[model samples]
Target: MNVHLGKTPVGLDGIAAAETVLSHVDGQQGELIIAGARVADLAAASGFEGVTARLWSAATTRSISEAEVRASLGLARQRAFARLPELLAATSGLTIVDGFRAGIAALRPEAGLDDEAAIVGACPVIAGALVQRARGSEPVAPDPDTSHAADTLRMVRGDTPDRGEVAALDTYLVTVSDHGMNASTFAARVVASTQADLFAAITAGYCALTGPLHGGAPEPVLEMLNAIGTRDNIRPWVDAALARGERLMGFGHRIYRVRDPRADVLKSAIERLAGGGADLPFASEVEAYIRTALRQKNPDRVLDTNVEFFTAILLDALRIPRQAFTPIFAVARAAGWTAHAREQQRTGRLIRPSSAYIGPRP
Candidate 1:
């Protein structure tokens, strides 16, 4: 039995692909390419909204205007908001998984029947689950007049989002649009293997993503920066972290040895938001300082920064509230997850990979 699946067989080093544009992850080089260019270069060249259109086209083989996607998402968000009380009420006194279960149970069965509309419809349900959980309040109505990115900002912040802020959020959405078969994507596909609804599969995915090692890392990345306080103490903070055997949360990735492509794209967005006066300098500085220190400490650890750093930074700039970060991730990633789930379902094979038992067994 293989321990790690080693290095992807069949020459497919990354996730399984049904269609491809440019999202490539070279773990050896720590590089990520998006739409025929490096992630960094893509970030520099396009706004997040543009990237969303690009990814959606690649996935669907149909051209969808940003406005169209936004309109659809806005409508979906509105519907999710209307049903929020039920979702939130069911979530009370329940664990995250229980809450997810309750919400999935509450959602109608058609939501997972494999149509574009239903697939898009699940976006807000997944997002609203997280939003309500984070806010400690029931979810609000999603606005149809707003863009998907803008509505997300509005739902979380309880206010209209400025254009620049909306642009930043859209970039975040686009940057994370899809990443091949990540953990959560696989979780979704596994649940779908049972012919479960989109809500069920995505809820399963969200549960997988809720771990600190995954979607939960970004929110804490900000918290870590805040704890570190200032740039002056970055080395001590990181050194102390290493000393204590605490693995740095946002500083590295399982893939991408040089740097995570998404990080560069998001970093560019962060700088733009900062230029528009978002005041995320302290967080940015600490991240930069930490990266430099880590590289110096063990040049061989080859620990370059990854998406979580800028994920925290970008969400912070968008005024998305720390608690909402993971959910926001769920919203954008649901697109990729559903797309992959559909592709997996088409293959008609249960994702029942055999695990090697290492311990005493029957």
Candidate 2:
């Protein structure tokens, strides 16, 4: 017996494509819950590795441990470093995002390191390599003794990061761990539904992420702010952009009618970082002015602040170049993609949605 609901709204809006215990995004109330905890509390409390374990536990039958996840990831990082020279040689001269994707695509199943650990652990290393390449510096090797987020910062900067810097990046990673069945997550599920390997599903998600509508917003956030230059230029530039019908990048989200909950989580992370300089304060003012201007321009439409706005600021505060924003995002989001793939595979059902035929009368 086959069942047909027969309602395929454009973009699958208001659709529950899959059953997931991993994370839920309540756009109306602006709430994000991950693995039975609210996103804010989870990010504040758990390290990214712990969050990865939690998400994995929710999807898999086994009770995965934080220590196990951490240990596996540490070894995976070492292996990734071992493979780096070869990967870079094969992928020379590609842009940061492209090179990062190429490197991940080159991953083959290994004897001891599972694809799960390989995908998650390789993200920071790959993204950091791109940053180093852009700066004309040699890629820094991974340090297994340090925590994942700390090592990520260390690699990006080629220097050991202190506790606070590590904490900020961890919070950023934990906050973006999952958000319902997003485009990338859905794409991952589709790939996994066919019983594909973890690497394939994650690579599918990564491909979806590279799309301009999704992963492209955050880096451009810094670019827009740089173009605005100073606090004084915020209002005028916003007004002109709105007049010229240009979007204020990072301000809007397709899913969230209210402000993105991740933005608040990240904005708070920014407050905890060391540099309380003019940038955050100025960005705060810009955020306020843009919110008001956007509201005034279209009173009915709610295009509230999204994660990308604060993400750009937070990454900038950590001194990461704009070019590596999406790659870093892929690193964090790989946690979610892994779990979603597992969850989809458990159902043993393929994602086969039908399109309504609207052309050519018989």
Candidate 3:
């Protein structure tokens, strides 16, 4: 049996090709390219709306305006809500992944047809369901006039978010839009390769993210913060965590050799909403202490702060309920899932990986 699958001949890693347009992840150097540009360079030049538009345009021939994205997502939110009661009943007592899978099955599009509008649109719908579930409330209707970010905030909070909160949510979505071939995106591509429809593929991706290793970090990230109780307790908390063998929730990544760029990007957004002065300073102190202690204890696995660290921070700042963090991740990630699904379909090959089959040869 081969220990690792040989590098895929057709799939390009670390290098950019023309099929999909969005950020490219240079895992080795920890760099991201958005629409034929680096994230840092793009950061100084563009806002969330521009990057999202550029990514969507690159994949689809249709020209979908931001207004259209808003309208479609708004519609999807209502549609998803209408289905929620049944979904909630069906998914009772199940794990979130199982429940989400139930929701996906319940919400799967009729017929064999694929609709980009529906696929791009289902993001906030799924997000709304997960958010409402977390809050112990029934799903709410989506507002058509609002932007995707703003409407999501409204749906979750039952009121429109202030400008700062909306801006922060926009930045969060943009920051998480794509991250090379992280676990969930990889799961999405694998399912898409089998020619699964967009919803199925995205459902598979959501399952991957529901695991603790990926999208689950954000919930614990905030818990860690709350456990510290006060600013002064942060260092001791870090020390105690180090003394035990617990890995810090949000402080590392597989691809990023340096810092995760998404962390800094979302941190900027959090600063805007959370008044990034004293709290941010406290966060910085906690991060620094964790880094030093981890390095001292285990030099090889450095475990620097990753995206989840500040993801929790920004979401908390936006007054988003803690339980909904992973669901929000799924919503933002749906865009990339849809885009990738379309890309896989264009390639038109079924994804089939062969196993070694070492058990008792026939």
Candidate 4:
């Protein structure tokens, strides 16, 4: 086969590999849209189920009601719960996120199963099971009557979540549900383009999100905050880190030259959840100091606070363990992954890209 030699940008930067209506990320404007709805608006007006239904509708090119989506996801959760014993047995001794990946792998997609619902529904259960097992406690089963965000908290804590907690979790889930063709979403589409099952494609997405450069920043953001300890240490620690040419966690983004839009939405969510708590005020102070220090250090570069900064605060306030941060991200992002996978499968063309050879000629 003759390979086409075309000019290719490094990392496929500024490349439009596939056209998608599921989500759009305008880095220049620092905006994100999911299926014609702005992220901020969607996060404010809808829950995870609503946003997920919209994404699914876009991917399948069919209209689906929120009630229908809720029912399907509830059923998926029950199906996944039925396999808990097998999942736990197979994922023994693995880390939380790895356990999630393992559980997904164990679930072979079948013709009768709603692949999208099954993958999205199973992630939270897997994440909750991993958290519980780590605490030497048995996993809690899903409550079909409860909402996804509410049930997730219930499963992990083995108790009912308050209304505020459920709202915060729902906002976080909706905000991070989709963001264009990001690294993990792209990986998912690649797998799906090959006519692979939704489980396989979503597992590929999880593999990509597990990398430190992607969904792994929120935990380290908490670590950085903990190391700072107090407001007085914020400037000194940030200045010292900048002097050493070290990148600050949660301060910068790859695409957004301006502030990340998702950051503001999550910041508001945290503010609502914290509601006069010392942690939120302190986090805000530290964020201000960090922003000032970064601007002073690199006057040209806009190193504003990204989504991970507030994510750390919000998840911490929710009492989610640091180790499970990335897993939670996967739980939220699974909706996007499955939607992109279905869209790619609809295209019916394999995602084949050419590589630029710079080595010795054969």
Candidate 5:
């Protein structure tokens, strides 16, 4: 029964595993479209709540209101807060994302809150709690009245974030909200295709995002910058790292043949936070130096900046620690995961792909 398709795709690259109207990534042109609009345009036009609502409505093929989603998430956060102590205890020895995994796994949907609302709403609560716990600080209560981005920073920093800082965070959350069929989104859809509950699918997505090749690269990007230590060390650092055959953490993308568009979106967001938050001048100087060095090294190839590069700087300026980078990514990407999950359940089949075996013939 040899039923394998054409040459099996390595890592499923170039595979159209699912069709989605939710988002599209045009790697050649470096464009991202979410909910029928360019990501840059959408991210610019809306906050996290608005972007999330748009994605949800597109995926479910219904008109879900942003205010309704926001209110539901607020209610869910209050409920999610009840489990923080237990989550903190259970996840004491784990990384922030691991704590999030435990917390998400523990979620049980209740009356008046659908699973999508429950997971998305509770994500910031869980992420913020883990961040606070990691810092040996008590988690602040969520302000359902405040926007999700502001409340998230509040819980982690134990202080109310100013308007600019809140806006920066909201921009970031919206920028990375959904990214076509990345590994994590695919994982979410795979689980959902199996008819698993939304929580189960989202948990799968969260687990996938913890991998270094995915959401885990931002902190390492910061580590690289810290290693360089100064603007003067930029070229020498690039040469040394390249000579040693180390991949620059945030320079290239597997999908994008050009500069990642999300890079620009986040870079602008960081710049806007320049009055107080992320050091835009230093980061720009470093980026320019590194980009030049990479282009000089690989003239025939296009190795340009990606999202993680500025993500590190932006989050660092916000006073978020290194460990929480991936967790916060999960917090932001939950919107995409839930939307993809619901879409799969509504429109796709159980994601069972066949494998091509090339072992010694029996």
Candidate 6:
């Protein structure tokens, strides 16, 4: 079947590859809607479990209550924890996120295992374990009674997190739970279109996320902030980077022509984090400087703040290390990945696109 290819958009930009009921990204307006709810409304009203339930219900045509979702995910965490020895062995000598990918890949592909719950549940456990292992501590088991965000914090940090900390993390998770057909989500859907199982689909999502063009920007955003070190250094640092033709890590996004709504949501969460600390104020100042400088420099380009800017701030404030940012993103985004996988599976069509043969004719 030789499908005629028109002028292919670079990087599949402005291309509608597949239909999704999961989420919508309106780039021109900088809006993100998940299921039937706006991102800001959903992030404010729900935690990771509620959002996950909503997404799952939308994807699978199953009506799952938030309570049921939370309970299932809690049990799933325990189930995932049972495979710790194998997970650790598989992840040996890899970077933290790579460890997470390896650990996820190691999950037993059993028909009886609830794939959605297992993938979502296993991600946090693997992520927390990697953090604990890096800190020279044994991995903590998930407390099945705790919320997913709270348990993740408790497991990773080895202590009870206060209400504010949990709330902040919950907001971060909900905010990033899903965005439109992003690179990783698209990758997951592509794999799913092949009738792959949930685990394999999400594993592909993690692989796509490891690429710097996708979910890998948060750590570099942190590095940029650290290099600047103070609000005063923002202009010179950004000028030097722009002058060298280097992309500003968090100031732009391919989908968001305006300020990313997720950025605004996370920034608000940072504000609500009891006692807006020195870091919040410093970040605000740096953000202001960068926005002003970038507009002046480009004048015609819409290089506004994206999610990574405040993601770095919020995660750093939560005391999550820079290296763990992408993994943590995967932890939240796994819900979306699996939901999209299920959606694509329902379509029962392989997403096989034809590439225009621009090379010499054979």
Q: Each prediction's Cα lDDT score?
A: 0.66, 0.86, 0.69, 0.88, 0.87, 0.87
Q: Superpose all Cα atoms of candidate 1 onto the true structure and report the RMSD in Å to 1 decimal.
A: 4.4
* 1 against 4, candidate with superior TM-score: 4
What is the Cα-based lDDT of residue 79 in candidate 2? 86
- List pairs with backbone clashes in candidate 1: 30-256, 30-257, 30-258, 48-171, 112-198
Better of 3 and 4 by TM-score: 4
| Residue pairs with clashing backbones, model 3 | 23-33, 251-304, 251-305
* Per-model TM-score on C-alpha atoms: 0.81, 0.95, 0.84, 0.96, 0.96, 0.95
lDDT of candidate model 6 versus the reference: 0.87
**Root-mean-square deviation of each candidate, in angstroms?**
4.4, 3.1, 4.1, 2.5, 2.1, 2.4
Q: What is the lDDT of candidate 1?
A: 0.66
Q: Please give, for residues 1-362, the per-residue lDDT of candidate 5 as tens digits.
A: 44446678889999899989899999999999999888888778899999989989998889999998889888888878876776456676887878888888888776888888889888888888887777777787898888989988988788988998999899999999999999999999999999999988998999999999998899988888889888888888888998898999889998999999999998888778857656677778888887898888899889999999989988998988788888788878999999999999999999998778765555
How far does residue 77 in candidate 6 sit from its true spot (Å)?
Answer: 0.6
Lowest-lDDT window of 10 residues in candidate 1? 109-118
Candidate 4 lDDT over residue span 262-309, tens digit each: 999999998788552328888888888889988888899899989999
Model 6 deviation from the true structure expressed as Cα RMSD, one decimal place: 2.4
Clashing pairs in 4: none
Q: 76-117, model 3: which lDDT tens digit per residue? A: 655556666765667777654456556665566733323544
Instruction: State, as a TM-score between 0 and 1, how close model 3 is to the true structure.
Output: 0.84
Q: Which stretches of candidate 2 lie over 4 Å from their true place?
A: 1-7, 276-278
* Global lDDT of model 2: 0.86
